[model samples]
Target: MSREPNHRLAALMAEAGASNKGLAKRIREGAARHGAHVGTTHVSVQRWLDGGGIQSQTASFVAEALSAKLRRRITPADIGFASAPPPPAALGASYAASLPDSLNLLDELAQHSLDDGQPSEILLPDGEVDSAVLSWLVSRPDGLPVDAPASRRVGMRDVAAIRTAGQMFMRLDFLYGGGHGHKALRHYFRQEVLPLLNGSYSAKVGNALFGAAAEISQLLGWTAYDTGNHALANRYLLSTLRLTKVVDSRMMGARILSNMSHQANYLGQVSRATRLARASAEGGRGHATPRAMSLFAAHEARALSSAQDYRGAARAMNEAEKFLEQADTAQDPDWLSYMDEAELVGEFCHCFRDLKRGPESVRFAERAVALTDPQYARTLGFCRMVLAQSQLLNGELEAAVTTAGLAVEGGDALQSARFQRYVADFQREVSVHAENSAVQHLNEQIRAAMAQLDDE
Candidate 1:
């Protein structure tokens, strides 16, 4: 006979600060968020508490919802796999009260992807609970014993080295594609960086190293996202957040939240995206520089646009512009330097395109294309596609065809599925003017490009 699953639902519930009723309510709410329907009832929740297993599909839903609420990834094993280790001594009331937010945040960060087939928004709950918990966790002092051996003391020099290496990796990643640089960076981090974190460092040195490691881990997540590996990206992101807590860098934590907001917007979770972006803006208030603030505002505007809140979006954009105006180059974080006026305007153009404001999109896109570096070929290609779309909408078929040709030329160097979608969109628009030789030729070329992509 098969062994009965070790059901730790009661323990898990306690750790989450959830009464049976609260658990039921969260289940219903989570279901609704994911476009499912599950009644909130004592009996339904009781089954879970009583150690009765749910249907596989329902289990997945419950797991996802609970994970979201807890802010960490909660596997069936976490609740109780068939055979599992005894609960930890720390798995008590205090731990229970904070577990939900941690699990939820982890889950939210862990599921992002940049794949073409993926939706363009990520849904996140309001930041109220997450901000509070993360703030407290990150602020705690490193409690390494004073009498520890010499091997434990990580020096400032070591921390500096790690930071320098991480900065180098970040620059390379931005210049090359993520796929080109990710593997070596990850390998170095795992082999060289993590061990130092485990060693005996002074409190100050340890915290700095931890912060550096957390930032690098976040870069790994970004690389995974860029490569279309959603699951891996999610894992890396979670690890990054966890490390940030150990390091206590509030600014870094807020930056990660902003990144999550960007991923959510890309995934079509507009409301969730807005919530995350707003949380990022609010959380980073004192800790982040003006450049970081501008980027956060831009993310919120992008989400608001996707949610069809044109006025709200426009207001956010305006605020972002104001923040950008105040940004001092020397004072800004290195990461924020890439987000210049052109990048901000490019985001606006994309937002306008999402909102179907073709003329506005075209105007903004033209400026963005003019300002962006040719080395940023993917971004340039996307701007061209947006311009072509705007021209098509304005009945300038010839102009649209010409712009799309330029986009295609740029696309030839990109390996992104999202970029291919732009090509498809351009082809669809050109199909209306198929009687024109230029349109016909462009369509044939697009089809041929798509065929080549398939072979690759």
Candidate 2:
């Protein structure tokens, strides 16, 4: 409401060198991909310049179009459109007692969460996590009903499409961060996947369909955690955990528990984190492959380290390393593509970092950096930052400064709030080196990078 003349939007247009007609056409084209019809013209653009209002969705379109041209992420607020909505207070909280119960809930939750673009500072209550986990622990896996629905004919092709989209969204989250494609992922799930769940299918086809839906739901939880909506993340993960029984996927349930442990640690629930991680390992032992089990053990190592259980942490890491060595990637599920040496080592490095074993942490961090895919900017930046911290602990000031600078560079390219948090936390830790000119210069770089992020 403050920018009555909409000068900010005009300036972005000029900066992107987009004419009124060109920008209007761009918005329409982007909308069309999402099956939205837009009739905007240069005339509408002119009205926006003269202080006329734009729709929230159109505002989002404008911000996205300009971000593409400028090659940086920006919100509607950056161009004086109304700020994106706050995250939902709660989502997908119910632990469905049956497959049919979960289907309707998942459908409703995916649609509800499509509008949750920003994280709320206030976290949701985490007590329900224990309740959901207990429910899942006792729930029996059920086969799809023998009698198929006659609503619409759902087939393997429809399941394939949902599976493909789930993979794509997972990759996008890995590359850019959860804040990047979360809403669009939810939008895709709601639009493309939910309808098929209601369609008619044979028991075999229905099993596959539920599996595909569980994958997307699991990803929705993962992204929600990355975006700092802890409570929302808990609900999504819980819902996905309930869905696992439908598909009879103990491995998937184990993965959900691992994620819950990860979030619990981040939220400072040390004991809960350790419990959840241990549960993942216990429940997934026979059901999960070496790669999946390795990841679960690594998570337990992390939670143990957080609680200052040195011997316990080391034992868990040993198991993880052993399992990692035995991993066979060729037979991995599509969702388990991230369960590799790089991810395993990254977790190991963080665990050591938590245990204050600086040299050991640095060793694992270097391996993580060396093995990490360059496209995974968020994880790479986080590992680099941890390496820098390890260097600082070892009294290697110059190496720490250089590594921290590299982390800052990697972080600036990402759209992840979580990665930004890492950079910020490292910045505070490096304050002890304030007297060194190199450290001060790195500090300046971080400040400028933060400004770039904050300005948007």
Candidate 3:
């Protein structure tokens, strides 16, 4: 299990005059230049320098960072990763054209993870991402009937079990975030859901089965996303889009595409984020409920905000608010039920914060924090961070520190890397004012609380 020291990477870093921390920052900057994001920390750089593995995509980022520093081109091979026959691209990263292909890709991805324990976190190129989005937009939503290819006779009861499990997973995800129960969810998906895809079913049952399978794929994608496993998460979502189309569920596909937009925004792919959000709206135009439409509009607003289009973002939010007012639970899917006033306000707060309208953000952030249900601690906690961040941006240093401390103190063993990044981002921003005693104390409080969460 011991890894040989990465002499090539180390030598290259030395030649480039980059320290571990500096190189890590450069790598992140490199990813950002490609309109993507990577959470490369100094510790991660140390691991790579010490011969620990880097994802193939991340290795490219590393080379890019060195290339920038040394004023020359660099490749993964130059850093020792591609010296042998290069490894294959990340599985499930590209678009799959057929049902069997999508299912097989998902199966192999799961098996690869279960087999090696460390799923490769390789990032895909931007063009591949664009290609997947384009494929989903053009592919037939009404898929050919699921061929009866297996002996197991799937029925309503079998489909119902998966639906019930999906609900349970949703509740747990809200309560504890994506890190909780993901492994078990994957196991159940591989064990209970994948096989059902090939089993015998009536047309009704086949459509129902594909919908259920798509739901699970969407959940798997979300859980992976929550954990900051960006590459894997993107693959899951791509498959989810294909499956949603297989069921001819334009509404579901809209939701899936909006989810993709959300992830793109997170990774700094602002242009793609906007494009996907618009696609979701276009594709779901006739099929989406008002609530679902509201959610879609919110995603559009988010992407526009990221692109710094204040007017466009405001227009989208107005649409979101308008749609939410007309939303009725009677007609909406159960999943869409969560896109209520509180959620829209939450998105409002996020948009305002992104735009640096601190006071407006504070007002909406406060409402989101107050309106969020207590049982959904992960969300409540995130709302608290937003509130703190808004306060900081507004120059309310005291309020910012106290709220951030509480957000951290309230943190439990809930394992969302996104949540951790929220904490880290605030810490990074607040550190500038650390000359103040209160800011210093809050910093200490944050570290202790984070350590406690990590321990648990």
Candidate 4:
């Protein structure tokens, strides 16, 4: 006889705020109290969720924990250790069917947009496609070939179209965050872009398209990561890496790895972040342009800083600087065009700030702000926050408040929760100087802005 599925048990664990480890611990502890010998562990809990049945004695302990924690009676029979039903065929199908159609639609849209020199509209239905299917597609191994002759030639027209789409998606992400516009982008990529990777194109055109698709996938991952959907982000990032490999673009792959490192750092996986960043820097060494190398080194430094390895971070920063000094905009790819001197300075300043090198941080931050575009509000906000913190460290309360105010203004147009957290950090720093008029005013303004955000 087949085993029962543990769907209800999975739901109960989630509702009880029990991680696999926590669930196993609870089971073991509860069983011990009743003088029952059970050898359950986190792995056992995971196995159970994956449809493995436990011994009847151990199941009794799990049931007891669930009953106590959920404040409802739950028995071993209710846990359901039976195998799950097979997933829908459409959900499990390869990209050959779904991806090709999606790409054809996108190609049509692209042609129309290029002809009119206007933004094309794409409205994906909410119900027809399973969100998880896209996730699965991105996670699957990259073995498909591009079948289209026209798509294989990524000309100036294609590049321009990709740039336009990327810019539009970036704007949407900045305005409404990842939740609002990411699905459409993801659907487009899964349906339209992935198929073209294998179509009949020259190596040159195919590689360029691969690079563009990789970038879009990274953006999709960023959106998902920003909104705290870690599993989805990982899938997107993995797909991006796979696409980058098709193009043999180490720099693009490194960038995706750096993003993964950043996500790992934020999630408190410091060791994983460090390892990922190190691997990225190493992988990017020979194939990457100076700008790409510098970017990768900077990412490594950031990860080291997060792990509180000040000396290691400083060394990495120094290497990044050397590469940055060697970088020429003329020789760099269009994707790396945005990594100008100002951005490099900003990255170094951030590293210094993390290491508590206040004076050095302030100097670089001031330069970064001066060189950066005022309209690039997010970067400006970050620079301002760094400057404020540096000034605050140097006991310059008035200067700190002034800088923080600029950060607040710059963050006004940004809807990122991470950016808001930076604002909150600035507010907390200034709140200690409550008696200062400028600080008081800054606090009031921040509060007003937060309130406005809440109302919105």
Candidate 5:
């Protein structure tokens, strides 16, 4: 699997007039600024110069350092590593405060995504969420009605098209799973949305365009998260939040943060998740639609439950219920329409699961499964698996096996990383009961279904 040396990196270093030791020192220092303590040495620099693969984060730091030295942006792609876009400017930093900068950043991200860029596999630390939240909290909002001029005269039709595409993608994600529409969504952003942003428009139209772009980025981030790509998800989310600031759309901003909270929660960063959830609520504040408020509170409840704060989780869930009572679909954004009673019950099911309250978990899970839309086959199966787990938790072995068999029936209908994890978990739990004929039969059925899917 050996490959050619990355001559581009060596050339860049030479252009920057940095020696091996010098480049390593600068990269180490740059990583320190980003809170990544890399002990890069001259030998590491030599290895990179000789075309050896480096850690993605390390390569990012090297590009960042070179950018500073060369007075221009450098990216992993520029250095002949994997074709990743430049890591975004430090989240919430001054580099992210301007509208033109935000647009440029998102455009770059869109291009990378469309190129099928492979991000580093580094799992973001828990503290990374906290840092991003802090930056957002203190960040100044982008000024309204962009003053910059452009070449082409853009109109509302373009904006409407983007919004319409967003709706389509969202529905696809809901029905099929994040994996189904991800590439198509990225293509839309790159081919359709990027040019719209580059074109000229009146301030009113410009603002609308930015809002549409923000929503697209939010959905992109959500899909990336759903597909188990946390680093990529964070990049999209940061862009979404930044774009929201440019548009000053509090509801959209809140929803984006809530999505981030869910990602953090699933990563087992409960403390970070709780903070992100609260930040989501604060983002919406006085401007929040009832649906927005309910979703934010539900996110917070999930985080609290994960953190083992039962009382706080209960309070948050009650607050969510109160907000749900006030929800008016007419007043809410199209994006929030999916957060209906079934979804709310599903969220409650997760909270109870985290709290290990088996009977309650099973109750909510059953209700969620019953109420879920039939088109959302993957979600229905996932909820059923959750019910099976809860049944097992309550010592109903036979019932658990039966429910799990039902879930396994349509497990391959959609491509979902989360569903795979759920399946693995169910398999492990039932292994203890392998001697039981029911459990054995269910396992055989699941294995057959999965193997069939693989063959197809």
Candidate 6:
């Protein structure tokens, strides 16, 4: 069967005199303004022009780029993608009130993501975050029990296996980066986990299964975020949040929202990031462990730092530290174990670096470096880059070059696009000192390291 040609898109491209390559270039450049890096190629543009659909996030980027060039309000619909639904706002659905709807929505989302393949770009819209948080807060816990068909039965052993697999994948992501194990997680969910959801189980077992699924989903979401698939990450996080509500797991839900906040902050949506972080804290009001609170506060601090509100950032950081002091590992959830003082100090390093407090940034970065595990390649590299950046800004050229070398050494071993972006930013910052021999040599080393990683 042949599909219809996108006459509207072809006509618009003709009117704008936009060659496929030209359009792709514009879209890629435009996407950066929204804090997204799109690998838009001429082939992508050709597909769009041939009546093939693009991801909603990419479609929005396309419309915006074309609208700017053509001086018209071009939309997804205008370009023959009106029929394609937008990326899901799944987190906003009230799990208790709409159990069946939420489950069906998640099922649809999983199928849609598989069908669309990996997204080439993502647009982090503020409205989506606000709506998700608001809906989560107002919703009640699910009262209705799951009624799986009286057929094949699921047991505690099955749930335990899922949880164990999730932990294994989480460890892989921590050591090797999210791109290392995200596909395996997606496959496990689709092949192994989905069947259990459809299998028969008592209400007690069903709750346990859903809770385990939520944790796995959250990891899937985190891995996607680490790999730079922000839109996919958001969808998975939303599903996790909804599942958390279904299981009445407030602490876990707060953790999910905190992850969402981290992504929002990365995308430069500072205001939305702050809102989500605060909302997460609020959601975890009674149940959040001290470690969890520390994590939330640190995220809030990052958002404040991004907005250049140094005092607010400082207060949030203090709160995080206070909470960390009170944290008891045994009382905290397993997920909260990683949110230790080292991580908090890394957040401080990030905050100070963003605020251009060179000495403070270096101090915290050094502390974080000492405390961070060697197995956490991506985190260590990020902290080193921040330290190098602080050294550069503090006018310690030799130390900056040396620290940058260390960063690149670790970077070469990781497969994280976020790490690459931060390194790129560091590269651009150091390029200003191109007159120095040490700076030039360090630049070459970094480029070579990145090239080796790419080739591998």
Among the numbered candidates, top lDDT falls to 3
List model 6 lDDT by residue over 199-222, tens digit each: 778778888888788888788888
TM-score per model over all chains? 0.66, 0.78, 0.81, 0.64, 0.77, 0.80
Per-residue CA lDDT of model 3 for 1-456, tens digit only, reads: 888999999899888888877787677556655645455656677877777666667788888889888999999889987843333456676677787888898886665331121332444666876777677767776564555567888899998999999989988888787857677889899998999887888888888888888888898888878877766777888878877767778889889989989988977788888988998888788888888999999999999999999999999999999888888643976566667788888888989999889999999999998898777788888888989999999999999999988887776523576777677778778978879898888877865664455344
Count of backbone collisions in candidate 1: 31
Root-mean-square deviation of each candidate, in angstroms? 13.1, 9.0, 6.3, 13.4, 11.3, 5.9
- Best-to-worst order by TM-score is 3, 6, 2, 5, 1, 4
> Once superposed on the true structure, which residue ranges of model 6 sit more than 4 Å away at CA?
1-36, 39-97, 112-125, 144-148
Writing each residue's lDDT as its tens digit, candidate 2 over 194-284 gives: 7777777888888889889889988888887776556567777878888888767888899999998998887678888998898899879
Poorest 10 consecutive residues of model 4 by lDDT? 113-122
Over 4 Å off in model 2, which ranges? 1-90, 113-127, 411-413, 453-456
lDDT of each: 0.64, 0.78, 0.79, 0.65, 0.76, 0.77
What local lDDT score does residue 158 receive in model 4, on the 0 to 100 scale?
Answer: 70
Candidate 1 on 94-154: residue-level lDDT in tens?
2112323433333333332222112212222345335443554445633333325655557
- For model 2, the local distance difference test gives 0.78
Task: Choose 1 or 6, whichever is better by lDDT.
Answer: 6
Candidates sorted by lDDT, best first: 3, 2, 6, 5, 4, 1
Q: Please report how far candidate 5 places residue 391 from its true position, in Å.
A: 0.6
Which candidate, 1 or 2, would have the higher lDDT against the true structure?
A: 2
After superposing candidate 4, which stretches have Cα over 4 Å from the reference?
A: 1-160, 171-184, 198-202, 227-231, 411-413, 434-437, 454-456
- TM-score-best of 1 and 5: 5
Better of 3 and 4 by TM-score: 3
The C-alpha stretches of model 5 lying farther than 4 A from their native spots are 1-95, 113-128, 144-147, 412-414
The sequence of per-residue lDDT tens digits that candidate 4 reaches over residues 343-451 is 8888878778877888988998899889987655666777888888888877888898888887786544435544655666677667777898898898788766654
